[model samples]
Target: MFRRDAGLMAAYLVDAETGELLDDLTDHRREFDLELAHTNIAGDLMDLDASVGLPGQLDPIDLADSLLVRYENLWAELTRSDVFDPEDQYLIEKRIGRLNELGFDVEEMEITTVDNGKQVKMVPRVVEHWHHKRRLASLTGLQVQENQARRLLNSLNRYRIILSEQEGRDVPLPVAAYRWISEVFNPSVQIIPHDLKGGLDDAELFHEILEHRWYLSEERHQDVGMPYAAQSYVDNVLRQRHH
Candidate 1:
């Protein structure tokens, strides 16, 4: 008969040999211990609820639209055709120039040339502009920046360089440009007041002034200094043209 005799729990089991023996212990697993283990198991089970176990749901329509837009843009960029005439060799450079102006650098291109001894033509197959503005800055030391900005600035700089040579004073190009901007371009525009800023942007206004000055110089058969050009342009043309 089984009975509690020594305040110890005992269980009968087969020993290492083929003989039976009684094992005793002072402490043993209780209902609470089994419940605690089961609680941990339940916590693990709860962690695997539907939200955690399920895959994410996405909007098919949105994803399809996004992919479609991506494909369209890529197709436009890669498939757009560029053509040129036999005499328009400069166009290739202009096309590459325009692309750079738009903040894009064509990395690779091959020019297909058609030669007939009398007629020669070339088409770009690969082209690119790389960190172009930065390179322009590093090399030129003057920063007008961006392709369009560089174009405008360089045009101004070229004229400035010519003006400096005409002056025969060894003045730096930037300084000359600054002088032209202040004396000729800016004051002419500013004279109209802030209410007229809408008629044209600052850059465009300056560009127009430059043109006016150029044609005036040609007409006079001499270099019309900024003072004469600014005064004449402001009174005769700028008021009628725009700010």
Candidate 2:
């Protein structure tokens, strides 16, 4: 049996004769070999790279220690009474934001009403928000980090709203998303000169562009268009960072 924690894989061997479980696979060469073969077969079936000894392999114990530290920090933050409030109208969004800030995602939430007030509890299923990634990929064909996907979605919604107002009609979501990808996102990122990009990916570069745009707009006391913003970011921010 194989268990995965924080991207580290651990295999448990079962004795064929006694039906006893062995915690360490390294001691038993036959069991280790069998398990490795099974893992390769599974990876092949799932269309994933099955190559052994890939880079960035972390010790499971070290991963667990780091995770424990994170969990402790999260617990400390959540224990504060001001962290969450039942009366807050935007409680759900705030809760999700807090979790996202700590590299966690809520898969399910439970709310209970008591004599004093309501209690909100979130069930964490994974470290990052895979659902957001999947949703964004399906809609925009962009695979990005959870926070990056959320930011891009927000930008897409804003674009859709503006388009709807300009056309004097409601623009469908899929159509708006496609247009945003082709017209806004793609063009903006494409204008970023290769030298100015540093080592950041497209999604990350776009996000930084958006942030730069907001800063420029605030500083200038006017809304500078996306194209101008992208160019300015390339010339100003990315150029400096690359140097």
Candidate 3:
């Protein structure tokens, strides 16, 4: 049996004497191979695939729900029209970038030349996201998020003069990232323990810690550092509260 949609190709063989199933393939054509004799079947992981949904099936409603959801999303993306003018070329790029940012890689834009090429209509043909994470890892050694890595690199750009001036060193970009991560963000984040911290994410926790540091400094009329801020947060705020 083969399911092209699932990229699954498998062959079933009946054991004549033992009345069992056997796999007879040498090389793999798909990620999984399945063998079944009546109700007996096994795939790579014994996948309960969609072919079970006959009129005599137990859960036909779940299958309909899944198909409805898939169709809904595809219909929304493909059929929905923003429908703008030719003068707004910047909006097209912005729209494309927004879709790409939302984890969709646009394959190509279908631009319609209406009114004999004077007017235009464009629609997205494809979209994909989560592409930047691997690319960022390749460009830089860090395996942080695409957005986080992008922001980190941007923040590092701001710290170029700091690296040159205070320590009197002009480091390379990768080394500078290391220095910034170690000296700035790491120490701040390291002060917070896993148990003491609430549901805040790492980057957000660091950012809030920085904000708390500034707030503590303003309140106490002194330069409260990250560690002190984290300590105070753990003691004064988190301890008193429950979520």
Candidate 4:
């Protein structure tokens, strides 16, 4: 059943992924549908598996509901208090930092002076995740998670510095990205065996290589290059999965 909302028929209870009717909205009554598809919800909700790393078998609708509750609770905590001191210069930065750490960007917000200008009230009108991933995609066209993008970006910046030093001039980001993609990223990714591709994507594999490089550098008291690090990871670490 559907209900008229603003002169439109809308579903009250439906399968989110399959869009199958579960209940009619006309009487606000629940209807059970047994033939709906079992796939996960489409679009951003499907990313929950990779983002939250939810283990074991779980229904998509249950996962989506849990995430919704989590976000709702976080929003309540962030905006419930309207008694922030306006005199603290670092308060805004602190809030923004906290939001970023929680994997959200304040897309739109409103700040108002309250209590005769003694206090401040802030409300985040819009929030977005994938902040680093969006920027990285725009620059390098490589889609990855926020943490993975950050690691890849650090490596790209290092590659940029290397290029500048080698060429005796400042290197632009696009040029550096092109070289880094060809030399560092592509080569490192290709070293992974085909059978092991199921474990991690290219960006994640590269991120692991960066971590391995740091560990090797610490052990040797010198920087271990990417090529050596990739080889060692594949030979010693990844090869065990096949056996």
The RMSD of every model to the true structure, in order and in angstroms, is 29.1, 14.7, 16.5, 17.2
Q: lDDT of each structure?
A: 0.47, 0.65, 0.49, 0.62
Candidate 3 per-residue lDDT over residues 1-243, each given as its tens digit: 322312333233334555424465332421132212212332311244454434545344454445446645754664454544433332343444455444344433334345532122234433123344453365445566555544444344434434544454545566766776777677767777787667777666665555566567667655554467777766676667643
lDDT of 4 by residue, 1-243 (tens): 465533444344444554436443432231111111213343345577557855675656676566556755786666654444433322333445455455444433334446643233334433233456786798789989876775676577656655664676768888988899999999999989888766788998898787777777667755667899899989877877566
How close to the true structure is residue 173 of candidate 4, measured as C-alpha lDDT?
A: 80
What is the lDDT ranking, best to worst? 2, 4, 3, 1
Kindly list the per-residue Cα lDDT of model 2 for residues 1-243, writing each as its tens digit: 666633645344545654446665353664465456555554553343234532475344444445546655666555433223333323444445566565455544444445554455565534332566777799999989866886676567656645664676768889998999999999999998877777889999998887887777667655676898899998888778777
Could you tell me the lDDT of residue 22 within candidate 1?
A: 42
TM-scores of all predicted structures: 0.32, 0.49, 0.35, 0.47
Best by TM-score: 2
**Predicted structure 1: lDDT:** 0.47
Q: State each candidate's clash count.
A: 12, 0, 9, 2
Query: In model 3, which regions exceed 4 Å deviation?
Result: 1-160, 217-223
| Candidate 2: Cα lDDT at 206 | 90
For model 4, name the residue pairs that clash. 1-24, 1-25
Per-residue lDDT for 15-80 in model 1, tens only? 555533445312243334444545564555445543465235443444444554665564455435
Q: In angstroms, how far off is 203's CA in candidate 4? A: 0.8
How well does model 2 score by local distance difference test?
0.65
Better of 2 and 4 by lDDT: 2
